[model samples]
Target: MGFSPDSFYIKTLGLTNTDDAEIWEYATTNDFVIVSKDSDFHQRSLLYGHPPKFIYLRVGNCSTSKIVQVLQDEIDIISQFGDREAESILVLS
Candidate 1:
């Protein structure tokens, strides 16, 4: 993976000029889900409403590898549980 720590928490799979709000917008627009450790994103998800999907990690202090593994473990279930009205967070432990 070419992901840096900054890229891990920040949006990286889209257009170069995209901002945070724009990233969120694009995710929804293109059905691309987000996996983030930032609580702010969870807040924004609620404040702005749902995109295609999102995973908000609440797990405390872990290395990037650990975080990636945790997310990979949950990837299959994400789409199964996806719904705009019912989901806004995905606290990984």
Candidate 2:
């Protein structure tokens, strides 16, 4: 299944410039997965555990379409990750 950008992306939420801590809290409260390249989210997930699971991308800077393609390639794994209650951090290379 394709991910919906209007419902899932930070830019769509008018939060592109928002602080990370607030973004973390918002995701936690909203039952949304946080997709980011920033290592800070990975570190935070490690420290605080779940509620808002994080997907960390190690692809460096890339086009939006490239990011989507990477995510699509891992959709199965991501779906599995969502079903497991214990997994809090998903690292995508």
Candidate 3:
């Protein structure tokens, strides 16, 4: 997906490096979803809640082309997941 610098809290906050908790705080405050391969965010979502939903990619290391294709194919599902009230995390494999 195309991301503008403004779309990332890290960039907006002028942060070069930050911890997960900080990132979580930024996302929650800004109502931005967290998309990552790290399971940390997934675990955090389960413990806390969703204002900042999480999208976890379960697929193993792959080419960028393949990743893009998978995302493109699942765009509909992703969009629907974002709208789910009770769901905090969406795992895409």
- Best-fitting candidate, scored by TM-score: 2
> 47-80, model 3: which lDDT tens digit per residue?
9988799988888898656766776788899889
Q: Count the backbone clashes (under 3 Å) in each candidate.
A: 0, 0, 0
Q: Tens-digit lDDT track for model 1 on 4-87?
A: 343333424636656667778777777766777767678787786566466777778888778777766776666466643577
List TM-score per model, in order. 0.66, 0.90, 0.79
In TM-score terms, candidate 2 sits at: 0.90
Name every residue pair that clashes in candidate 1. Answer: none
Which has the better lDDT: candidate 2, or candidate 3?
Answer: 2
Candidate 3 clashes: the total is 0
Q: Per-residue CA lDDT of candidate 2, range 1-93, in tens? A: 236643467776788889989999999998989988999999999999897999999999898788888888998998899899999999998
Error at 26, model 1, angstroms: 1.7
Model 3 root-mean-square deviation: 2.9
Q: Could you tell me which residue pairs clash in candidate 3?
A: none
